[model samples]
Target: MVITKTLDTFDSTKKLAGHSFTSGWLLNSLRENDKLYSQLFGNRLVKDITAFDVSGGKGFLSIVLRCTVFFVDSVNDTDDVYTTILKIPGFDSFKNDFLTDQLRTIFTEFHKSECDFYNILAPILDGPTPTVFKTVEWILDESEGCIHMEDLTMRGRTMTYFETVNLAQIKCLIQHLAHMHKNILCSDTKIWKEKHLKSSTGFIEVLDMMNESVEVLLKKCDFEGKSLK
Candidate 1:
């Protein structure tokens, strides 16, 4: 009777046969205690959560301790919400040709910019540049011939998204690209010159792809007379 009452803290006694939650730890035990979380989601990495309660990051950071197919939390005492950053599965399911083409294009432009930074235009910058990335929880799912990325929970962490997307990040991305093409961005200029030249094929391709995606998304979401409801 005593043990049963303590276990009732979760207020529900549904036991998932082979699953459990990570619990008993001080910081997490108070709110997230449950054998279900411990057993069902033991693979996730945990991170420092002291500063997240206010950053809209509490949800994502909390799940770091337990990896699962999706993020789940109780939205209200009566509701459970599950969210994920990438929802379209693998590349095969990501069939929006235009969006695929756009991502590839961005990758290509990233390559071109990298070449310039590595060979000619890069040497002028005297110091190392900063790099940042935020994961996007959703991307447009196109395999069905429409635009849709899984919209995320307000608290779930995601890749950086922009209010007004711009070209500057592409330039920064190129710098990262330069790092990949070590011949160009590394500390060896002599070797960079020895290697072949840069190409704009990637840059133009990405720009064109993103432009197309933006146009398509805007059109699809227009509320003129559509039943998007």
Candidate 2:
């Protein structure tokens, strides 16, 4: 069965997920033990919460929001703060039938793949990736769904754009990729089988279809150059 929830703008100053940010929800989501909570919020309660939409993320599939949590520490009676990012899928409604169908398939597979990644692959991987605090999937339609994950930005992690890459950074990225590949190569294939994740050939099939369309267009135009094979 699939579950659905209306995406609502969160009010930072109120209770979230059963408790105020200063009371229990924040620490519980972080998986902090009770001892740590007593040591941290001795008496003071969480006062307010704030969220800012992080811009410049170029993607049609999802939207990102950065949340800042505020609370007063009970021990010293001082203010303390923390942050977390929320990733929400971007499928509200579609006008174009072809595009909508294509995107629905793509988004569905993407969400399932990510869920598999967090559930199956991440535990064994020693690669550079954000710590996932939680993941929630919302069923929108029969074949469409969205995923929400913990924001890595709260931990000072930033996205690396192509224009900002340096040679050193590129090398580091390659090393991280290599480490991930090695970990996957060493893991048992049964782990993936248990999760019902199989390799996908849908993208390659789509490319082939596009190539055929290109060939037809080229013939119709009577182009002389080599065909896009």
Best by TM-score: 2
- What TM-score, computed on C-alpha atoms, does each candidate reach? 0.24, 0.59
Error of 2 at 142 (Å): 8.5
Model 2's lDDT to the true fold? Answer: 0.54
Q: lDDT of each prediction vs. the true structure?
A: 0.35, 0.54
Report residue 139 deviation for candidate 2 (angstroms).
1.3
- Top lDDT prediction, candidate number: 2
Report the C-alpha lDDT of model 1 over 74-193, residue by residue, as the tens digit.
Answer: 234223322212111123312467456556444333434443453444443433431111112222332211111122345444456564545897787787666656634545667446
Model 2, 1-229: lDDT tens digits are 9897542233434533322122234444543423433465434355555546574555445655565556644243233555565555654332353354665566566666776687668887777666565565545463223233455553555556654777999999899888888887888877764464332654653564457667777888887476556
Q: Enumerate residue pairs that collide in model 2.
A: 12-49, 85-151
